[model samples]
Target chain A: MEPKMPRKERQIIATTITLLAVVFIYGYIIYKKYILENPELVYNLEFWGRKFFLMIPIMIGSLIILMIIFAIVNKILTNQDMETMTDEMDKLIELKALKISRWSTNICFLLAIGSQAIGKEPWVMMAVLVISCFAGAIVEAIAKIYYYKKGV
Target chain B: MGNCKIKNNIRTLRFMANEMTQQELAERTGVTRQTIVAIENGKYSPTLELAFRIAHIFNTPLQDVFSVDPDDLVLKKK
Candidate 1:
């Protein structure tokens, strides 16, 4: 309506992008500083398993906190409520965006499995899996923004 | 066809209805204001039920509220 991203959705996307950036930076640091320091950890399934398991809760917690902060700031700045009605169009756009995200993630999953089936290292599969998930999420967010601004 | 678009008279209808606001229309139609804006601007098309609801609100037939582009029909005929 404003020729820009709707306020509530804009904040959600902004928080998502911010959290994604933080995760990427954190992953990069861990890989470069910690994993490289202990090369054996790369081949250790237990280490990867723990990292993946811990990351899920941490990511969720961070996202919830960020969303709350954004909501508070938005209320202070614009005096608009965070909650909004979801209508048919919103549902339609969400389904379309989700379809795009699913396809991208599925393709990456196949690639990851194929790498494992071949002779690629275990770490390669793990990296591909992680990247595929993040890429799918980012793509979904971008698709939502596009559809919201340009119409679905 | 991709070339065919559903044109609507929502803007005219709103204006004729004592300059009804998009927010009011949205509330009457059980949707968001942005959704009403999108429909009026022809950026999005409503579903059959939604079309009926809008027509009901304006006390018009569905055909009066929405129609296909005549040019598209000509292209189809060609």
Candidate 2:
């Protein structure tokens, strides 16, 4: 197997995935409300199917652009040495961060379900989702800093 | 609460055994380089199966690879 990717590359990939997921969810909402309102605009199943398939290329292009930016930053920071992986301690800190993020995400999902059961508004649900994503990211960053400080 | 600090000499032994790199040792033991690094740094405690594998890779006893100190925990007599 290939060596583990550098932390910068991993971060770029993670960010790209998160960005694509958020964009796709928001785009789906718009498509359902605006585009689907006119059946004539729907054209055919194949046409909409093609658009769905097109997301792969769009995501790939976004990832490539992200990687290019990451590569440039990595080169500038490391003086062209990109082969170095993150240190062990840094990886542990990332693991802790991911753990916290996972927990936050799960809690947010449960809260969403709970709100839905209580007849919450759609806009409120959307707000909760957006805020939860940001909160999860913040929690992850905090967890990383905390673990680093604790020397774990 | 119990003292969770664990002590091992994997780093010292790795040095003695031709100064093997963490990556090389990790490969020999069929684990990720990060796992080896974590074990050496005491940031993560490996499971019993992994501990045995590490000990086997170093040609050392299992106790040489990992040990829990119970001195900090007060035990009740049965």
Candidate 3:
């Protein structure tokens, strides 16, 4: 019988597989850049669309395969232990976090719209998106801290 | 928000039950490992259903698993 790999080893393997996928995608972008630079190459929306469709399947396949491997490895390492369900406490925390994220996102989006209406630069919209993400994370973190401090 | 307080003996019971692992308890209680850790640390409160499940797992009555502390009460007479 083959020796079962430890949880740490399995996690490393899974992470490596994910990283490999990212690397492969980045390499494809470099290749596309090279093609775009070539005078002989004809670039059009249809050509790029075809490339995107091909890439999607490869990405999806890799993700599914990686997930399956991760599940198998996790099961083996944990001795067939089932995944734990989220308890009520976790649900409450998650609900609070989600509320924070939603409020932040909504407020940022509204502010961005207002800025646009007030004749702000087009690039300002990008800043809004970035700030929204940051604000969401901050709000979630603050909510967690507040709830913890309040003993809820 | 309404103040809802619940007290539980999970920490003491876990120690008496041969120092059972939090992960093991979480699995048995159908909750996330982090949730169990949070509950044990008194950082989070569980729902009624989850509380009953936990009580069932320890083979104890619901009152034994959880209680409302009188000290946590804040009275308001209308």
Best by DockQ: 1
lDDT of 1 by residue, A7-102 (tens): 746764876687687778778877898698999899887888788887888788887887788778778866766656789998998899999999
lDDT by residue for model 2 (A30-65), tens: 579657786564545454455546655776676677
lDDT of 1 by residue, B1-78 (tens): 555688999999999999999989998999988788889888888899999999999999999999996777664443
Instruction: Return the TM-scores of chain A for each candidate in numbered order.
Output: 0.88, 0.52, 0.44
Ranking by DockQ: 1, 3, 2
Q: lDDT of all predictions, in order shown?
A: 0.84, 0.67, 0.65
Model 2, first chain, TM-score of 0.52
Clashing pairs in 3: A85-B32
Considering the two chains of model 1, state its CAPRI-style docking category. Answer: medium
User: Which 10 residues in a row give candidate 1 chain A its minimum summed lDDT?
Assistant: A1-10
Q: Lowest summed-lDDT stretch of 10 residues in model 2 chain B?
A: B69-78
Q: Comparing to the true complex, what docking class would candidate 2 get?
A: incorrect
Task: Give interface RMSD (Å), model 2.
Answer: 6.2
Q: Report the lDDT of model 2 for residue A136.
A: 82
Better of 1 and 2 by lDDT: 1
Model 3 is docked with a DockQ of 0.56
Q: What residue runs in model 3 are displaced by over 4 Å at the alpha carbon? A: A1-85, A130-134, A141-152, B1-5
Q: Which ten residues in a row have the lowest lDDT in candidate 2 chain A?
A: A1-10
For every prediction, compared with the true complex, DockQ reads: 0.73, 0.14, 0.56
The sequence of per-residue lDDT tens digits that candidate 2 reaches over residues B1-78 is: 444678889988889889989979876766666567667888767667778887888899998777767764566455
